[model samples]
Target: MGNCNSCPSKGNCNSDSGCSGLVPKYGKIKHIIGIISGKGGVGKSTVTGILAVQLRKLGYTVGVLDGDITGPSIPRFFGINDKRSDISQVGDGGEVKFAPVETSMGIKVMSLNLLTEEEEAPVIWRGPVITGVLKQMYSDTEWGELDYLLIDMPPGTGDIALTIMQEVPLEGMVIVSTPQEMVSMIVKKVVIMAKKMNVNIVGVVENMSYVICGKCGEKIRVFSKKTAEEQAEYLGLPLLAEMPINLDLVESMENGNVEDYVSKSEEYEVLLDNFKNKIGI
Candidate 1:
């Protein structure tokens, strides 16, 4: 209920701004998942995009909060870039909030990319400042009756990510990882940080776990030998998925449209369906 300074949950919190997101008695959502990665370039935002669409297809109200301050890509991934409304006051002067751009799938999305004029412009914000903005997004936005609020967090266990985990009441988190060995070690840091904050580990999404041969569709393990599955097992977590590398999928995402990027294989579909059920949406 105060400024996020010297809070009890230090390491887990990324920000301690003037955020009362969980204190309000007006309404609340069922699930809030933070899509976090151990490091960068692991397709964490891509996983967030697919998850929102799948939940909407199942007939649920979805909302996404782009928590990555320095690099906010969720809006671009959803084709809502360059769309922003002026901030207006909520009911009874509660807080001045902006309207989230609506995606084709009807998932309400918010990100700094939509607010900014340039997509590639560097956002030089400190850790505490970024954390305060995250609280503003959560408390100020018009996320009414959401079935899920998927937060696209920045890569690594840095200051901002830690602040959000400590201050915000997270329902669960989906850890994104590749099969690389060095990155696997950092993932343990993310897990330990989450545990320290008492946030639930819903599932682990292994992006780029393998590469599928174009002609024969043979699954090729591009990175480390048997490190990904081993990590999940050692952590005693459910292997949510093993996403294979696909170029066409990557190409589709470059334009910020995921409306038609459906997984062709049965295994991918099973993984998608299980994620929805696991989250109970």
Candidate 2:
């Protein structure tokens, strides 16, 4: 029998007996990758959006599961915040399934923001409710045939994070952090948690590692340059990419046009290449 750790039955019955129900019945996802961080404001969601767009551009079908239920931003980044997912009944038992909204570039996305009446409304639910919603979003959404499904996880090792690590069949995880020493220090907690859960750590992405001076066109290291490298080495993981603070990209995301940025930006070409190589895509 296969590992029943993620099965809804909690391993009471053998998976070979056809009692397992962990994998989403409606989706054939080739790879499920979680984008996570130890703390907030580390640009984890942005990284997720960029990766989805880049992967789609490479002719691979991709999907984004906004696992950050309380602070869902995947829809906004992909310009699908105003759209609602379509619900339909499927199967002999009449099981309800949600059709994920597609972005301009055709990347499927499912998020709490898409279901809510107002995007600005706060998700006031407690831990259990939030985790339940996350599981439903993963299992109930009709993701179709996808090469990659990226889960933009909430920050920290909390209830939602633990639920995903425990229940979701995550192929790997990409840890996001800034170059600040404090952030790097906190990111170690995430690495430790992933190890404890027996999840593969794909690598670390150092976001906002530097900024470019507009007048001189020089790369300025805002934080210590060695922090991310040192952190990755300490965690025994590869440094996937050192992303600079790009104002244009920020503006693009703010405008809900991340696909445009991915296509037009020459700077992100290196990031895309590095991420693809590290992810083995």
Candidate 3:
């Protein structure tokens, strides 16, 4: 490395000649992909967590917005429980700018949990109120620039999803499902909802399709087969992946750390690479 004794940056600013040192500019960010599943209890939030970590490890500035108001789980999945305090700083023209509480990865984030003191409390707002809050989150929070904003949507494509589709501008959506018929059928509801909203289909991911026996070295497909695969073919899109049932992953997640698996997993490499290529990243 060349001598940097007089380098203007402490590694946070630009080095443009004739210009004061400033935080480096990465340029305009383009896409926002919502991670959605048809119904609940299919490990959708875990999948989102894995994707977010993988994307960041690959050097993309990513953020997550937990749109699943009824039961926000993203914060817990990532093991982040920091209360989001409003940050106000006087800017040019005596104007005040507010920033949301960001996660440790430097990903700006906000959720209903941030405002509430307890996670078990229920959010029973009407459809319009819910929509208003989401709209405010988008326009108010200074997300700055992000390569991908993976939304962990609520279980079903209900009133909340409709309101979000009508309000927030999104690039596309990724569907998550399980191998069971009941689960796959429920998630199909979101697919229909996405179609009605005219959102681009990123792809589908099957979570917990099979489990590998610890001692036997045998793979058991407890859920059905050909569900996600068949759906992808019928929809004329690609199948993102089917994450195997790894007990280690479950332990890591429970300990508030899923990156323990996603970071070094080969499956993640293939899935993320495919996502980048398909989305023109």
Could you tell me every candidate's TM-score relative to the true structure? 0.85, 0.89, 0.80
Window of ten residues with lowest summed lDDT in model 2: 1-10
Can you write out model 1's per-residue Cα lDDT over 1-281, one digit (the tens) per residue?
63333222335556546444343122356667898987989988888887777777667898888888888888778777767745677689676776777887888887877677788888887777887777777666766677778889988888767876875667688888877767777776888888888888887888888888889988888786795669677555777888888776767667665566652334456557667667664
Q: Which model, 1 or 2, shows the larger TM-score?
A: 2
Ranking by TM-score: 2, 1, 3
Tens digits of per-residue lDDT, candidate 2, 1-281, equal: 32343333344344465533347767677778899999899899889988888888889999999999999988877777889998888778977888899998999999989888899999999999999899888888998888889999999999988988887767789999897778877888999999999888888888898888999988899778575677678767888887888888878877987798787767667667877777676
By TM-score, who's the top model here?
Answer: 2
Clashing pairs in 2: none
Candidate 3, 184-271: lDDT as tens digits: 6777778878888887778888888788888997878887756557756654557988778777877876785666567877866767
> For candidate 3, what is the TM-score?
0.80
Best by lDDT: 2
Q: Which residues of candidate 2, in runs, are more than 4 Å off?
A: 1-21, 89-95, 225-227
The per-candidate count of clashes, in order, stands at 8, 0, 2
TM-score of 2: 0.89
